[model samples]
Target: MQIQEKIAVVGGGSWATALVKILSENGAEVNWWLRSPEDVAHLQQYAHNPRYLSGVRFDLDYVKPSTDLAETVAKADWVILAVPAAFVQQALTPLAQDAFKGKTLVSAVKGMIPVQNILITDYLGEQYGVPAEHQCVIAGPCHAEEVALEKQSYLTIGSHDIVRAEQFCRLLRNRYVKANPLDDIDGVEYCAVLKNIIALACGIAHGLNYGDNFQAVMVSNAMTEIEDFLHAIMPLPRNLTGSAYLGDLLVTAYSQFSRNRTFGNMIGRGYTVKSAQFEMNMVAEGYYAVQSIYELNKRLQVDMPITTAVYHILYERFSPALEIDILKDKFK
Candidate 1:
C-alpha cells in the first residue's frame, strides 16, 4: 500500500490520540474508529480527544472520526489497532475478514489476549486471516504524554516485511518522533509485553520500600528474564539489548506515566487486585500479561523468577510483600 492510501486508527485512548496526532502532522486524512459515538462527536467538535491527551488538539481537516468499525476499516487501506489488548477482540468482533483483506495492519497494543495467550499479530492472523506480511508492530521507548509534549521519542516498527515497516514508519516519523525498522516483529512484540510485567515488578518493589539499589538489580535481571523467555519461544537471532527491548523496559519500569507500574504500586501498598484495578480506572496490561506468560510457560517452563513472583502476587492472591521477600533469594 502507498503512503497516500487512506489510514484508519482504532481505539480512543491516549496512544491512539498520540498516533492520530502524529498522522495529523503529515496532513493525512485519517479515518478513526471509536466505540463511543459521543467521543467521536467530541473529537470532531473540539478537534481533540476528549478522554486522552486533551492538550494535543487535532486538525479536523486530517481526521474523520467514526463509531462504525466496518465502515471505517472498509474505507482505509491501512488500519492501526491501538486499543488496549484486553479490549481488542471486542473492538474487532464487528468486522469481518473481508474488511482486513488487502489492508496493512499495525498493532500498537503491547499486551497479549489473556484467553488466547498469543501476540496481537498472531491473534489477527488466527481470527481474521490477516497474513504475517500485512502485519506490523509499533513499539516504543515513547509514551503518549511525552509525545503530546512534542518531546523527541524513538519508535521501533517491527514487521516481517521491512519495506512495509519503513513505509509505515514514514507515516509516523516527524521532528519529535523517529522510527526504526526491524524484522523481529515477534520478538519485539513479545518484549513489549514482557517489559510491562517487569515494570509492574519494579513498581511493586518501589512501593514495598525497595530502593533504587535493589531496583537496579531487579531491572538488570528483568532484562535477562525477558531474553530467556523470548529466545525460548521464538529462537530468532536478535539483539535483546536494542531500544525496542531494553529501552522500552527501562522507561516503563521507571516512568511515572506507566499504568502497569502504578497498578503494581497499589498492589504493593496493600490494595486488593480488584480494588487496585477499580481505583486505577485503567488497564494494567502487565496484570493480564503475567498470567498469560505463566500459562504459556507451563509447557515451555523457562525459569522466570520475576514473572513467577508477579504471577503469584497478581493471580495466586499471595501477599506482594511475602512474594517479594521470597523473590529476593532468587536475585543475584
Candidate 2:
C-alpha cells in the first residue's frame, strides 16, 4: 500500500500544486495532470505551476506532467484528485470505469458533487465504480497558502483502511507538515464539507458589520451545528473538537486564505452572486456545498440554524443583513 511506486496528482490548482510541491520535496516520483497544455509546458520549462502556487517550484526530474487524464491516472498506483469538486466529474470523464479499479483514490476536494449531492468519495464510488476501500480524503486545517510558505500545518487522512491511510500519511509528513490517519471516513469528509459552509456564514457576518463579539458566538454555534449534523448523518464515535473538524472550521472561517469566506464577504458587501463568483475566478466550494447540504438535510432533519441561514441568503435571495438578524435569535 506504499505510495512510492507511482502517484498522480489530478489538478493544477493551488491545492494540487501545493501537493505536488510536498510530494516532490519528499523526492517521490509524481505524475501531474493539468488541463491546459500551456500550463503543463510552463511547469516543465519553469519548474513551477504557472497558475496556482507559483512560488513553490518542483524538481523537474521527479515529476511528469500530462494532459491525458486517463493515461495519467492509469499509470499511477495512487491517484490524488485535487481538482475542484464541480469539475471533478468532467476531469475524470475521459477515463473508463476500470481505470480506477486497482488504484487508491484520494480526494483532496472539500466540496460535494453538485449533481449527486454526495461526498466526493461516494461520487467516485458510484459514478466511477471505485470501491470504498480504495477511497481516502485529505482533511485539514492545512491551507495551500500556508503549505507553500512551509508553515506548520496538520492534515488528517480519512479512510476505512488504516494501511492505506498510513501509507498516504507517510508521503505527506515532513518537517513543516504533520499527518494523522483516521478511521472516521464519513465524519471527516462530511465535516470538511460542512466547515466550508460555516466559514461562508462567518464571512457574511464580518462583511455585514458584525463585530468580533457576534462573530465569536456565530462560529461557536456553527460548531454545534456541525456536531449535530454529523452526529445525525454519520453517528461516529469521534471528537468534534479535533483538528479535522473544529480546527478546519476555525482556519477557514478566520484565515485570509479562505476562498469561501472571500465569496461570502463579497455577498455581504452588496455584490450579487454572479458578480462575486466572477470576481474571484475560483470556485468557493461553499457556494455549491450549501445547496447540496440543504437538500441532503431535508431528509436528515438536523438542527442546523447556521447552515439554514447561509442557504437562505445564498440560494433563496434573502438579504444577508436580514438573515443574520434572524440567525442571531437562534444562537442565544
TM-score of candidate 1 relative to the true fold: 0.98
Runs of candidate 1 exceeding 4 Å displacement = 1-3
Model 2's lDDT to the true fold? 0.90
Once fitted onto the true fold, the runs of candidate 2 whose alpha carbons sit more than 4 angstroms away are: 1-3
lDDT of 1 by residue, 223-289 (tens): 8888889888999888878999899999999999999889988888888999998998878899899
Cα lDDT for residue 95, model 2? 85
RMSD of each: 1.5, 1.5
For 105-216, candidate 2 gives per-residue lDDT tens digits of: 9999999999689999999888889999989999999999999999999999999998999989999999999999999999999999999998899889989988889988
Each model's TM-score, in the order given? 0.98, 0.98
TM-score of 2: 0.98
lDDT of 1 at 168: 88
- lDDT values of the candidates? 0.90, 0.90
Window of ten residues with lowest summed lDDT in model 2: 1-10
Could you tell me the lDDT of residue 6 within candidate 1? 81
Q: What is the lDDT of residue 41 in candidate 2?
A: 92
lDDT for predicted candidate 1 compared with the true structure: 0.90
